[model samples]
Target: MASGMFDTPIVGVVNNLFGGLIDAPVVGRLVRRGLIKIRYVGRRSGKTIQTPVGYRRSGDGVVIHVMSPDSKTWWRNFLGEGGPITLLNFDGADRTGHAIASRDEKGRVKVAVQLG
Candidate 1:
């Protein structure tokens, strides 16, 4: 799948093969249209995080999926500070949000990050 575009050759091949099992473009479209919202939590501080992922919307509240398989810098910061994140939305406004995820959630924020 196209998701493998961000990975090494072998990993990309694996990602392409695995992505075939899911409708990523549909989900991406849903996410872009604001129907799907992605919620991230601080790995260390237990705070809610929200960000408008690049995708289109199918309707309202469709599942937002993650493509990468690792942690990011903001994820690390969220872990250090436990509080809900207010993400910037369309019209340059901030959105009030919270995040709650279980082990079975579509995506999970982990406790790893690079700060350089």
Candidate 2:
């Protein structure tokens, strides 16, 4: 009776719920420490989308590992070469970056971003 979080049906619900918590004024303070809000434009749809994901600082930028890659589509936008991205803290302070997504031989996906 235990369904996975990415098991369709409720993926959007989970994203919206977590996204709201990460963007909240008070609760976001702790959550945003490890999970910041990421905003990007869809390459094909030309629409702006915001999602909350876990990331860590890497050199001058940050690295985000996409969980259950097959269940997600956002990272695909950064495939091939890369694209412009904006990472925002709970306070709404954003850091602009260029993101390139790569996959290991094991099919694990991760996005390496260079902040500017």
Best by lDDT: 2
lDDT by residue (tens digit), candidate 1, 3-81: 3444357654653443332224545433335432334565666767543333332232122333363422343343333
Residue-by-residue lDDT tens digits, candidate 2, 1-116: 22366666676787788888887778978877788878999999999998888898888988999888977789999999899999976346788999999999999999999998
Question: The CA-based lDDT of model 1 is what?
Answer: 0.37
Judging by TM-score against the true structure, name the best candidate: 2
Q: List residue ranges in candidate 1 displaced over 4 A.
A: 1-52, 55-63, 71-83, 105-116
Q: Show model 2 residue runs off by greater than 4 Å.
A: 1-9, 90-92
